[model samples]
Target: MNFLDGILFALFAEADKSAPLMVPDSVQKANFAETVRKLANLDVDQLLQNLLSESVWILIKVLIALAIYFVGRWIVRRIIHLLDAVCERRRVDVSLRSFLRNTVRVVFTLLLVLIVVSTLGVNVTSLIAVFSAATLAIGMALSGTAQNFAGGVMILLMKPYRIGDYISAQGQSGTVREIKLFSTVITTVDNQTIYIPNNSIATAIIDNYSTADVRRVDWTVGISYGDDVDTARRTILGMLAADPRVLREPAEPVVWVSALADSSVNLTVRVWTKNTDFWDVFFEYNERFYKELPAAGINFPFPQMDVHVKNE
Candidate 1:
């Protein structure tokens, strides 16, 4: 179908026509044995010289190809090193730099291999055609992986989230550990590792907690209806002000009665803190509320039932 295939077919057809098959009789067999013995008895020096004269150029070419391969491989490594240095100098993101360096190395190695094959008298064009066909078939078979790869490239270029950033995407939340070609590696708070396909992450909503310098922490606490609402609110505000981790410039901590529940009054407390101190502030506040609320005579109300019994 293709030019190389047609050429091979024509060569095979000609060879088939020119070549003859012989069914030898006893006399012909005896003469063939005698001829083989005479040829074997020929001078060794003359045979060696003839063989060398015919194959010397081919042997030289093979050696040259081998030399080129070794030298080209060394050069490729040096080029890769130079590329790494350039990326380092430019202060590129580590993940993007690594991906680019690997891609460049693979491309250069492929080119070097093609050069070597061409030097060995192989048809480079035919090899390229075969490779292209195979690649196309593989691409069709792994369309999902191809999409992930494309998404990974986009992510590396766009940088929606960087490594070490805590992000929630694709129904999972974790710190981004690595951004690979087809997937991203994440480590969760519970020390679990997850591999999320890049395509899913790229398409889904990404919640990056570390993108902002500060984050808001909300808490809702219930107090008995009989307790002093002003006292509870003042206690929480004083606690937030005392904590150095809570931010106060942009907006101060807010405490207000949010809702009147069936058994108690729900007081909402909102505070701002550094992103890194959000969890610490949250847990510490909860612990302190449990301890200090009781000391402040603030009763955490519980459900109760009142019943009256007559003549039963």
Candidate 2:
């Protein structure tokens, strides 16, 4: 007992001994002894016997509660597995799988917690009400996060680009490395990494270069005004044709007299090739055109100013 309780009990014992009823020393000692001695008396023993009778009921309650918790946990796991299987069966978007899995796991854990609390005789309806109120407050506090989450959900549901697709969006152009609910990861051509938030990505104009099987390579060639325009056109077309990477199925390369200036005529050349061969073919054709056109007696135009000699 605490010191205060000990002093109070001793004072009470002394007062009892001085009472006119005149209780004996032996009886007073029994009444004032430690709680352990008091509990060992016959009356206390009978009270304990009554409590032991109800102990079995408490054990049963504990076992039932434990069983509910364990079984509920098992059910939660099964639900998660079922969700994963459903996604696989429907060929659902992979970017959303991780998000859905985490959400489902948290929800199931919460449900299990609620069920266990209910089994232990907690007032679950009130608990739910309290949790809902708290959740509403939290939602208000993190409204920006809610908007991002909504955008993320939309991005996952409607995939604009998949992993490894070369894309340009939100002022960044790169090959998509990974797509998550919150952000889209991109690795640029120069190997620089960039992350675009889902909210911005969803609203921006996305240029997906990897979508098309073929990409057109565009280049402009300037020719001297005096050179044979017909010869230049034929030579450029021939170079495009000789390259196996160029797509002949789309017809021969288109060469047009796009622009005419005082010094030169600009010819625009467009060639179509498989996306994989785009860079290789474009570089090869540029080098070939620059080297071969001159050898073929076709003049490449350069800036020139004619200086008239003044005769005095």
Q: How well is each residue in 26-81 modelled by candidate 1, as lDDT tens digits? A: 75577567666755775778656766765886798899999999999999999989
Model 2: per-residue lDDT, tens digit, 123-195? 9999999999998999899776677677778877777887778999988999987665567789999999998
Q: Residue 166 of candidate 2: its Cα lDDT?
A: 91
Give the RMSD in angstroms, all C-alphas superposed, for model 1.
6.1
- lDDT, model 1: 0.87
For each candidate in the order shown, give its overall lDDT on alpha carbons: 0.87, 0.80
Model 2 lDDT at residue 158: 76
- Angstrom error at residue 141, model 2: 4.0
Candidate 1 clash pair list: none
Candidate 1 error regions (>4 Å): 1-74, 119-121, 303-312
